[model samples]
Target: MGVWHRSLSRFFSPDEPHAAEPQVDQESNLHLEKPISEPLLKAISTNDLPTLRALLETQDRQLFSQIAQNGTPEAAAYLLSRHTVPEDYSQYIGSADPILHPTQYLIRESARYGNAPLFRYLLTQYPAIFSSQRWNNESILLSAMQGGVGIWRVILDYYPAWKDAEFAGHHGCVLEFLVDRDKKELIEFLLQEGLDTDRAGDPVLELARRRGAGKEVLDLIRKYGG
Candidate 1:
């Protein structure tokens, strides 16, 4: 598993039983260290634009990077208003700190939150960010699938490669991920987008069945069966 997947596995599958105690302790410690200043994070979370603007003016404007990861249109607009030239912006594009890469962070966050306008704005402003990879070389499409069908549609409309991109881990393709999550809308979307839901030896439908997926999922499988 990749670093991101390994770190998240415990929280996502807490009942799996392995080394829970130490992981819990580490998680607690990690949460104690607030990377973003409390006031700024609070302002972003509460959508207090005035407080956010004041914080940016008084505090280090560099802290504005935090808002890019917030996945809110307001935060995105504020960040865009302060856009530097492409030359200067390059410094932040691939920063070692993932959160500092405004475009990449915004793309991932927007996908996760189903914020099409924000995603579109970032794509228009920084098309190069789409070429960047996140954890395990996963594409923005994988992140969008994790959100829902709306996110998938908004991103796939602009970046069709997402449909074919396979995730690094056992999650496999977008179809498999949607099936595992029981995301009926995304499953249908992928099918409509030409995903071979009934490909030979593809266990996606079987897995969904074992998960006790409802009639919607079963009907999708039947409709698309080859």
Candidate 2:
């Protein structure tokens, strides 16, 4: 999850810029950043559930499958309502741009958006979407951390083992960001959830010290085995 700049307009109101990384496929020559053309994408971004339902019913199955693969949680639920999860899973959930796999896209969107109800709904409706064997746990964890404590907690409650998932240097661990922002509560919550304070770039304890973390925050890091 090394940072990549992208527009939020494709997934949200144009006025609201999303923090999630934008993607472009150079080799495949897919312009992912291009304006939204798919009707499903427009419907999902606008929260127009009825139009989404109509599109799902009237469109080609593969078209619905391609769009839904990288859709938001609400859109995913609606897509699932009409279509069964594909048995040859890849057949039902891929696009011209392989980088935007549904599993990763869904996790990134659900976690970074910080919508607890929608996140929970997607999890409940399509638990397999985030199965550790299929999706990157590190990506899920990093994105959840960016989403704040509430979203992180939802995923943690669902998959306790992920609490210990080690982050790669490129995954953009949230500890440094949290310490930089002096977000003590979120830092503490992450520590309590058992995220390792030891990172490749800057260990949480050292970063906190350099950033002049409050006494309470330092104590929390140590208390949680930083």
Candidate 3:
């Protein structure tokens, strides 16, 4: 913890011309670089839930929104659930710029970890988050593929358009993602959804074959004659 504080102090040093004005601790006459905010950020980053809860009791609710910027999926879930509706923090909810907003990071992390509850909560609370895309126009569905099949299904159920969405990668759509990852259930799910794999010159099947997909996957592809 000492190392973390020291490292952060360097960036928030009073000498840094662009640093935000530091707050002074009345009793100790200590110049806190960012006052109570720094500790809250550190606690969230370190996953110190006890410390985070204690700080929250006294800190501003606005700081809770900042957790989405870099906090872990677990931390995001805890903070969001503990706080009331964050209507005041809407400005930082989601952004399309390369610089990731908290909501965008939360979405990506939730999908990456297959945290369906958190993903659902955030989606329900702030549907606008989906309107923004991450790097290379990556959608929440693309990120969810990295997690487990349950999360993938949840996202698909909530946002059907994701099945047809193309991410910035070799895999074009959900079908290709399931094939590449050898997710048989997801593949079957897409098949049931009437995904036409019979296109005469579909590149995904060829790509799947070249990538050494399992026989089951190849057979599924064959069934559709892709």
lDDT of every predicted structure (CA atoms): 0.58, 0.56, 0.57
Q: What is the C-alpha RMSD of each candidate to the true structure, in Å?
A: 14.2, 13.3, 13.2
Off by over 4 Å in 1: 1-77, 81-99, 134-139, 198-200
Which residue pairs show backbone clashes in model 1?
none
Single out the weakest 10-residue window by summed lDDT for candidate 3: 91-100
Which 10 consecutive positions of candidate 1 have the poorest summed lDDT?
A: 4-13
lDDT of 3 by residue, 1-226 (tens): 2332323333222333534443455632343322446888899999999999777554423333333233334455554554454433234332422122445556666666666666676777677666543332355566676766666667667776666666555536667777778987767667666665644355767878887799998887777657
Give the top-scoring candidate (lDDT). Answer: 1
Better of 2 and 3 by lDDT: 3
Number of backbone collisions per candidate: 0, 0, 1
lDDT of 2 by residue, 1-226 (tens): 0111132124332233442344545732344434444787899999999998776544434433333333445445443444443333233231212233443344455566565555666666666656634335555555566667778778778876665554464544557656666777888887877777766676778778988888888888888866
The C-alpha local distance difference test score for the whole of candidate 2 amounts to: 0.56
lDDT of 1: 0.58
